[model samples]
Target: MSPSLFTSLDVKSGGGTAVFSFLILLLLKMAFDTFGYKMGMNPWPGVFGWYCNPAYRLFDFLLGYTGFLVLEKTDLKVSSWKISVIQCVTLVFYFAACHLFDKQWVPAPFILLTLVLIFAFTLPGGIFNAIFGNRVLTHLGNISFELYIVHQVNINLMNHTLLKWTGNNHLLVFFMLLVISWLMAEFFSLNPIKRFVTKSIYKSKIFI
Candidate 1:
């Protein structure tokens, strides 16, 4: 569940470990999916209905710690562009490998490229901070935790209700889910509820 206790090590080492874990999880998921498809089986376990599978749990744990390690190690003088670059390269390689091996990898490259573009956009701000001694992307980075948490719940709830009522229209459902989730995240992040919950949990050190 929680990362190993040793995850509190130096940020760079922790980050490297987290990234390694993520890559391992991603590869494992691909292997599982491949084997499942070949055998005509569902890839995810039944409990949690697709959310709390071993692959997802492993990746989520690594990603959460990666963010923590990045925040811990961040310095105004040092650019975080290197981490972004490494993330992008790893994502690209993972997708490329999937595409090479799987006939169903059509969406993998597109998804990975979108993530790479997002990281690339942040790279400039990181470079500016390193050169001009300003924390340009600090605020954007800070809200990311709240955004991640809120977005997933919003998306899942919206998708489930819409599908139940309207039946399956995949593209329409996806766009609606995306728009609703982003709006919900933005709204919730600006409200006092966000601050109250975050402070009550993280500040109180009750759920660390």
Candidate 2:
């Protein structure tokens, strides 16, 4: 999670190569899944059935590499509005692609479109960073891992409790979850107890 990890020489070299390999593997897995379903054959069986699909391994591999690449390549500083817009667009495209091409394998056209969108959205930030430097981006990057860890637990608890009281108001639940997750992330990031625990566990290499 440390920003330093992203820019390490090892990551830039091996990590990038690993990511590209994983993407290729993922395409292979999708092919397998499609073939299996079409032929009415259950190719994978037993416990760990899900992992039998090559897709899962490819995904994990991609995440490992792409995450490092993103950290290394992008300025972490971005306005919330810009971040939200990118997220919304990405989600829309992902769902649209899924719905439109459910039976088809990952369409090359959609993949190319996605890559174009990513580069386009990133250009403004790249230009700004060239002129203004990356101080804001680096600071913003620090909070990301902490936010990821805290948000899910905070949201899940708030969602369940709110549902019991409010009779399934999705909007209210969503907003509350967002607000509470942010607050919890902020709190945990600063809390002495949490810091102590995190450092202790990390030092021991016991949590992973």
Candidate 3:
């Protein structure tokens, strides 16, 4: 059983990436979080709700592209002050995400909250390179994508199945899921699998 694939269904102000000025982007995102859906769903089905899914994809794409830009910077310098501010905002977003919001990522608050945090930490001041550029973090980030794809469904299945037989143990369920997800991530990230994927994609005319 894969973790349920679902996005949050919630209210939104929209127009963060375009039309709005700089500050409004952040504001609108936070606003969505504050006003959007307030709960998580059990794994979603193919495709997601209308409002949030496209926004999520755009935000994520921009984040990765921004990281690439940061890494490629030739001579730009980032002030420590800006990094500090971003870090502070990132923490704020995290606080709101965990405490002020509900469990779902796609609905109102969680979607905006989580994405703002990503932007806060990864979007500016060359922090992307400074942090994820580290060898370990980079490797994890690579597999992290694949892990995100495979880990959740299986873990959720495990949790559901185990809860019935073993009753309920938070520690046991979380620990097992974490460990298993890591192993599965590692397996998908292994050299052989990586090469196979690369070659397959390379040979595919669809990519070309």
Candidate 4:
């Protein structure tokens, strides 16, 4: 995913290439999910099972690339209200699909999420600015990579150590984990630590 690679792929150019790529990746994901289910090899069943699949990871990366591609390539002049409405509607559909459907091999949720992300990346001025343009979100974005790495460990630690203290209140445990994770991410966001962590992550297979 370097600039040269993207240029070579010509993903930014208008054509059926991107669409075809997405379709092929989607089919691969479905195949992997079905195979994993049949073999009982997926430790995390349902939608979560797709996370560990190589095909799904490629789809995920392409989905994200599509977001940035849309942001850079599109010149839509729609109203902020319309964009916000689209964002909200897409999110509603995504959540509904996640809860109502068995996602063993379904791609509805991911498709909806892609719509949400595409709109989100192209957020215009006005209400969108007032909301997503805020400093809190900017700060969170800055430390997002750090959060991604530490948040899970923080959740596991809190579940083991703090859940009993909170009388097994999962909600409270979640907030505690969130606070600790954010603090850890913020601490690691310091320039020196951030650089080292980023270098290590890029060198390892853990980074997408």
Candidate 5:
């Protein structure tokens, strides 16, 4: 989305408009993804994809817009240590549920539950920084965008190599996959694919 679009939407204004946009954009993105996945044929790239991608990104923008909305609506300092503690407790469940489930669809209440908890725990001065804050997590978070894209490729390579090294120790292979994926994520973050996005956004007069 363009900066102007966000400004025009006043997505931070925190009321009915924000709520409606947030919900609608997310639904649209999900619908689009499902449609794409079901098409079976290779998706048309280039101009066709360029035009179609914003339906997905709007959902991403609304996610951030939601945090600001929550702050405005609640008017409570999320920094309260008590709130952060509560948030972290819920975060433990959120992580557990994510790790445990196949996640075709998360239960609706849990969706609301986890978002609020994550907001409280992760905001500045929140307990997440105090308890889980460290170099490893910070670096992983920094490169998370690249990590999502690059980790699987690196993991596949490592899986084969580790098979030879450990004679098919799946436990050790999984551990090494995590470590090597992080390293590869770091590498890609430093030398990124952002050039294409940068050029496209600038030429198209779109926002970051």
Candidate 6:
């Protein structure tokens, strides 16, 4: 389903509905994983098989849609104190999950963070808004798609070619990846470079 069709149910006019739909989507995602596994269709855990599954991809797209819906599609009117409480509660739940499951609990952090961000959308004059509402983040957002596409390649290239420069420190390697990926994304976003690539691809008949 296209996100544009449902973009009207936004925070300003439909905050309750938006939150409810977001939760429902979360439940549906979990249900699909559970039933897909029971039916012998979902990928085995940690195998990366679900990445190729059409059903999983649909839910992924919906989640991404709703994620943006909560983040930027509407004008949120939540107070900073309430948002802070939500953040604290989410952190507590995340820590509890990690402790009980004896694992790193990846989804918990993302979901919890999303929840906090949904409410943090309109913290006027607040540090959270000030921190994220910046030119640097705007630049990153502009290149986010390119960054996603090229980040893995940059990581692999750095690991193979530039590890010596960092003395094999993974922390430094991580920074190197960030810088390289941002630079690569900026390069790809340049109009002349984008047109060149598009023309080359068209000449190769890739569009057909």
Per-model lDDT = 0.52, 0.53, 0.53, 0.62, 0.58, 0.60
User: Which residue ranges in model 5 land beyond 4 Å of their true spot?
Assistant: 1-21, 29-74, 78-80, 95-114, 124-126, 152-165, 191-193, 200-208
Estimate candidate 5's alpha-carbon lDDT, on a 0 to 1 scale. 0.58
Deviation (Å) of 32 in candidate 4: 4.7
Model 5 earns a TM-score of 0.55
Tens digit of per-residue lDDT, candidate 2, span 69-181: 54346555677567556656765787787788876653334444455444534545443344334675454345555555555555544567898877988888888887776
lDDT of 1 by residue, 80-99 (tens): 76755555575577667766
Return whichever of 1 and 4 wins on lDDT.
4
TM-score for each model: 0.44, 0.47, 0.52, 0.64, 0.55, 0.53
How far in Å is the alpha carbon of 51 misplaced in model 6?
A: 7.0
For model 5, how does the per-residue alpha-carbon lDDT over 1-208 read when each residue is reduced to its tens digit?
5445566457445447667765765565455555555443326564334123434334444554553464446645554677767676777877777677634542333445556665666656666776758987776767865565555555644567888899999898888888777776666566444555545663474454
User: Tens-digit lDDT track for model 3 on 96-183?
Assistant: 6677544545343444455555555664554455766688877787776666665546654577777666678877878878888888
Error of 4 at 195 (Å): 2.2
Candidates, ranked, lDDT: 4, 6, 5, 2, 3, 1
Q: Model 6: per-residue lDDT, tens digit, 49-108?
A: 444333455455556556666555546466677765655565576556667755333242
lDDT of 4 by residue, 135-184 (tens): 99989977875676567555644576797898888898889889998999
Model 1 stretches astray by more than 4 angstroms: 1-92, 100-142
Which parts of model 6 are misplaced by more than 4 Å? Answer: 1-62, 70-81, 84-125, 192-208
Clash pairs for candidate 2: 76-137, 77-137
The candidate maximizing lDDT is 4
**TM-score sort, best first:** 4, 5, 6, 3, 2, 1
